[model samples]
Target: MSKTILITGASRGIGAATARLAGARGWAVGVNYAGNAEAAAATVKAVEAAGGKAIAIKGDVAEEADVIAMFDATEAAFGKLDGVVVNAGILDVAAQLADMPVERLRKVFDVNILGAALTAREAARRLSTGRGGNGGSVVVVSSAAARLGGADERIDYALSKGAMDTMAIGMSKELGPEGIRVNSIRPGLIVTDIHASGGQPERANTLGGGTPLRRAGTAEEVGEAIVWLLDDASSYVTGALLDVTGGR
Candidate 1:
């Protein structure tokens, strides 16, 4: 039988890519979106076209009720979840630490760190065998900025991603005995609209030449890594911070 997976922020970018790839692998997918119903719907169609079952679920990861609802709805649709990707995150216009307002920092941490924590918490509850659930996997989408630091820009976003890395590490140990595996992915410059949202539409391409690969990664590349972590093929892997950074 095929496995079931829920991907938060699946309307576009890395989330969408992962949904499609998982679908193609014959997994049922819950495509979760915060507000863009159209994009979520599009992702649903894409998943179905890729030959897997799918449903578009609307929920804000930053809201506890919404995160719970998203997971509840997914379980309702697919029976149970075998994996979850905590992929929902946000970035603001790039700015140095001093130039960034307190409100901006709050928004960044609220969605990136708190949101991820809430989603991962739900995953732990639903996937843990100790909680009357089957064993499963959880993948947190972090960023390379966690290691390099955003430096001149987006230090706040970088810090938030760093928290995600730590969360994955800690959860892996906490959840391991429960039969649930947890891992994190740190992606480098990749072509995604997130940069546009961060006020640097050309950031990925501009920085691609500096990487050893001399090109930015595609969402599909990162998606492949996530799917590997979620699949049984990587059953022995946990507490790993996999970098899809193309040797950055």
Candidate 2:
């Protein structure tokens, strides 16, 4: 049986990689993008090329209506969802908390916290066996910054991710009896455009050498972890935080 999944922020980076991997496994995918239709379309094409079905969904995760619509559109296109990857997140230019403006903080929290919460809430509504739907998994794309504390860098980003970690654990425990599994991935120093968006195009390569693996991780690496959690192979797993940090 072909399973269906929805990956937010799937237009690029780890989300795109996960979509492709899931597609290769013959899963139907919903590729959700906030404002990158071209990139989202490209991901949908890649999923189809990989022998799976895909659809490009446009919506901002921060908006409640948009998040609900994303799910409705996916289930409408591909039927019930077996999994959902809450991969939508945003990071501003690297700066200490003292130097960051209130607007920047709000923007980060709006997407990373509010958006993620909204997505997970809907997943619970749709995937919970107690809610008249089949059981499924929810994987949150958190960050290594959560544990690292961000220090002199963007502590706000770290704070948001820490909140994600808590949410995943809480959801897993709350929904476990209802047959919904929840987990999170903490990716470290992965080579992705998110670095460029953070005003550090070379951040991963530069800091990767410091890791015990002597290199930065790839989006595909993190994607693999996410896919594993979404798959039946990890049936016993829930509330776990898998780190794709290459031992960073």
Candidate 3:
């Protein structure tokens, strides 16, 4: 049987790329989008074109009820889930910490940190051997900003990702014996619409010249790493933070 995997925020960027790549690899995909039904449908169509089964799911990761329903829907559509990519996240316009509003901080933490934690909790409950699951993997999409701190750009986003990094490390040890693997990927300067959402459409291109590779990475590059973490090729790896950054 083909493996089934769910990717949150799959309507665009790294999540969408991962969905397409995973489909190409013959994995049934559950493409979850926050609000872009049109884009989600497009992703589903792309997956089908790649010769894989796919369904678009609508849910906001920041909401617990939505998160629960999203997982239930994925299982209902695919019968079983072998893996998941916690890629749903958001960031506001760049600003110094002092200039950032509390509302922005709350929103960032709620979606990026709380949202990931909730998703992982549900994944563990369903994928753990102790819970009667056959075993599975979870790849959290974090950011290089988690380590670099994002300084004056978006410290809230950085802090949220930092929380994900710690969660991956801690959960890996806790869930390893339970037949569940947890890991995180920190992508650096990927050329995706996320930059546009953050109010800097050319941010990646502007900063690409400063990286050691002298170019921003692509969503497909990060997608490849995310899928690799979910595959058996990385069976011996867990609680690891893989960076898709170009030597930044």
Taking all chains together, each candidate's TM-score versus the true structure is 0.99, 0.99, 0.98
Q: Worst lDDT window (10 residues) for model 3?
A: 126-135
lDDT of each: 0.95, 0.95, 0.92
Compared with the true structure, what per-residue lDDT tens digits does model 1 show for residues 1-248? 59999999999999999999999998999999988999999999999999999999999899999999999998999888999999999999877899989999999999999999999999999999989998899999999999999988899999999999999999999999999999999999999998998889999999998999999999999999999999999999999999999899
lDDT of each residue in 150-213, candidate 2, tens digit only: 9888899999999999999999999999899999999999999999998899999999999999
* Cα lDDT over the full model 3: 0.92
Model 3: lDDT of residue 112: 97
Error of 2 at 239 (Å): 0.7
Misplaced by over 4 Å in model 3 are none
Cα displacement (Å) at residue 52, model 3 = 1.1
